[model samples]
Target chain A: MSTPATPLTDEELVLERLVALLEHVAADVLEGPVTDTGPGSLRRLGLTSVKLLEFLVAIEDEFGHVWDDDVEESVIGSLDAMAAHISAAGVAPAPTKRD
Target chain B: MHVKGIESWDLAYDGRQALHRTEDGSELYYELRGAGGPVVTLVSTIYVVSTAWRNFTGNLAGDHRLLSYDLRNQGASDGRPAEFAQHTEDLKSLLDDLGIERTYLVGTSISTLICRDFANAHPERVAGLVLVGPPFSPRGSSRRRRIAKSWLAALDAGGPRALFDLIYPLVFGDKAIAEGGSGAYLALRERFLAINSAAQLRANLREALGAGDQVERLTSIEAPTLLLSGDDDFSTTESTLDATAEIMRNAAVEIIRECGHLPYFEQPEAFQDAVARFVASVEEGTFPAPWTAPATEGKDR
Candidate 1:
């Protein structure tokens, strides 16, 4: 059977979903050092670039999108920044990204 | 009392000594016991040494060959000048040196991670796998990030002691620790910590820690797989167990009742039975689920 059309086009949603994913990755996977946070308190998590790719794969699974062409290297730097990327893509950020 | 039918032997691989070296050129140690068909090996994880597999191996070796080795940087293996050397390669080299064509794999702790990678890269070499306790990984329900925050890098700096203290609680469940033999565990621990420098331990950790989402990499492991864990194993949470089983094309998961992380140590009888059942199932060419997608079904396009 042919697939039904998606309401949101693929391009419009990719970046935003990836940002949402990075935030989730930070809390659960990376356990970012900044347990308490503000715009000024971005402490680094231990995830090197290669491990970060694993998180990206999980996000792609959660959103059902192929991260192959959509992921940008800079978009994953921080949870707040990642949230903004996802929010810009129209999905509202959840109250907590820990799960 | 000791396990009733338990056995021990000092057999060698391929009718020869089973000694092999690590990635850093450190000689590793092992004792091969039991004698049945051929199940490739036994590998050490963090704290418990290869000796822990003594009884289980004895029981299963009737028609199978069991190879249990003290991994480099741990147990009787040489731990000097350690660095994150090629662990899978060390295992392969052991097999190659022994002249054994192929056999099943059974490992514990994070040894499963190493075995999983080896199984992926050399699918042809692995007949089946029985991994116990699982290990630390980001894929779990919730990871304990706080306790050993600098643990890995510390091991890289100091040695096994850098994380062995924290790891003890993670490896042995609460009851086992309180069973009132603190000296036994500490002595065992000191022996492990004394050999390697912290930096070498760190290198071992970096190399042995779980590969990210091995669930995906494990997709390529077509061998029948068996996973054994305890209900209260802190190292392997429910989510991690479920995620692993979901991804493997052929696999089965068993939770040992009233047991801790060291199922082989905590409940050797049950562990033995579980192994017997899984191996029998493997010989029959079926599992609770296939370890990979049915090759008969074409690609998932």
Candidate 2:
């Protein structure tokens, strides 16, 4: 018997969704919509680290990914960088089913 | 060591303090004791310094190589930016500096998140986890916001002194308060207040609340785990720990009686017993995998 392989999500589509997510989180914290300068823009806006952590959580929720040890500070540095990182990293693999 | 009283002398006498430098150039103060066996790093409660572990360290140190450290911006550790993530990194660096490959993590209060996160991020480096009063889940955002607003209002209305007074009951159990009296509780209260680190603690608290939910990710944890929460612990209750245990592959839960959040200090004998059993199981390779561990059968010790 043959098993069906999981379909891969398009990278651009993933990036588009992530950008939208970041934009929403930024607006929530900044109290207004922000330009797509990426997460680096967050630092300029004087975003607190607590808010930054919330942003990361939002990103994880959006991409279905958790921040691993390899995740550098720069991964969330800007919108474009984060989007690219998410696109390249892709959605975190669904945990394998256990008995 | 600055030994002030008999209590201070009891704590300072056992372990030698050292500064573990991180790549960020911040130095974390830690004290290590014990001998040839599994390494156990005790992450102190945010409310107290490393000495808070003094009650049980003597017992723990005899069988396991135990290490306890002050979180950055608390105790003897140098002040720098206090981010929850940075605290985890500091722990990683602390373990590395000590040349410890893998060890058991014993964390209390908010530091429980540190142990879990470290285990999640570096599973190979964590042999097992003992989380006492881990904030497995926090109140909803609106509720948290309301509570925070009220707290801030109180802070502005009164001051740190008043705020600390208000939160004292939540920190210590009725039994502890009754035993220690207003005086012992006051002495313990004075320790945190005297440090003038309210702002530091506030920042850490905010980070912890905003650190996001880890419920979905608990299945990723592979290490043998033991969770402890007090019967009187209002924050992280038995129900919360029960929910937490359901997700882990291997976990055991114990609710300590006549204690609140800080069991290590509140009930050291009971705390030591739980930890000693867990550590021994891990060392002997007899710890059941999370999948095999009984899900709903945690004992109340």
Candidate 3:
């Protein structure tokens, strides 16, 4: 019998979703695979100003999070930070339609 | 930044940069360079900031007093959106504050319309006009409308970067893009992203799209005018430039080959040469004398 897979925690799930969104939005300019979730990881993954803005928009669209004009950069400084910020803000993912 | 060694053109080189408060209280960011020769005021397109004319300013500043400014809603300037008339007034205020008696205006793209309106409004203040890639019709074509709509949609969806990607091809010619290659393109993209934001670009576009046909206004400009167009510029054709020149009292058309909407960037030397020649012709009184249309031509003969 095969061992059962460990279920992902809520934070892990958010991180996974954020990575996916970054990959989708940064396909063209990404330098390498996005494995790191530490601070400045977005910049490390080769997200420039343009791609960063697109990624922010994607995050808002996916998570229903509206960024304030004066939002702290540290909140968006890394994948993990963004995930934590999203969870901390109590932003629920937008409801998806059943196919 | 993917590219290295790209020199910074953001700062004023030997000149002074300042923000002038218009009568309406909007701050207009402007740069004044050089001094002795004729004043050549550089007007920017909605997409770019005053530094976009760095090449032009560098080339002409040695001989001419260069005045380059960011209109409201442009780079390093206030984000307040204003119409063409408001922009014209701001230009007047800037000139007054600088003690500029008159200037030869060099404007590109949507700003060309601003130049036309300014020349019409303050005919005495304009010594000559260099209208680059001017839109001939006030009422744009259906195709133009479709493009504008798509641009707005792109801006709404992904911000200024998305809008830049959409317009990059349309704005530059094949020669320019091919020559610049990927590195050059990336550098330009970085600069554009640094200067522009979605909300600001959206406001500027709205004002640009609402611009009226200034063809009638062209007739009122009596200053020596050069309607400059890039041969590869799809936005405005040579025929359109010729027709626009016909409407003015003293106007001529100059086409710079292998260039697109922005000639100074693509073919700087050629653009500089053309502008220099025009200015020389005007100063030397060698420019073509104003042509008078035959009275019978407009009437049903």
Over the stretch B66-117, how does candidate 2's per-residue lDDT look in tens digits?
8888888776677576567777889999998889999999988677778878
Better-scoring candidate (TM-score), 1 or 2: 2
* Residue B70 lDDT (model 1): 66
Model 1 lDDT tens row, A6-89: 776443355445445556655554444344222322224434222344454455456443332233323444445444555555
**Ten residues in sequence with the least summed lDDT for candidate 3 chain B:** B1-10
* Fraction of true interface contacts that also occur in model 3: 0.00
lDDT score, candidate 2, position B271: 79
DockQ values of all predictions: 0.01, 0.01, 0.03
- Winner by DockQ: 3
Q: Considering TM-score, where higher is better, how would the candidates rank from best to worst?
A: 3, 2, 1
Give the RMSD in angstroms, all C-alphas superposed, for model 2: 24.1
Among all windows of 10 consecutive residues in model 1 chain B, the one with the lowest summed lDDT is B3-12
DockQ of predicted candidate 2: 0.01
Clash total of candidate 1: 18
Candidate 2: segments with Cα more than 4 A from true spot: A1-99, B1-15, B138-159, B288-301
Q: How well does candidate 1 match the true structure in TM-score terms?
A: 0.60
DockQ score of candidate 1?
A: 0.01
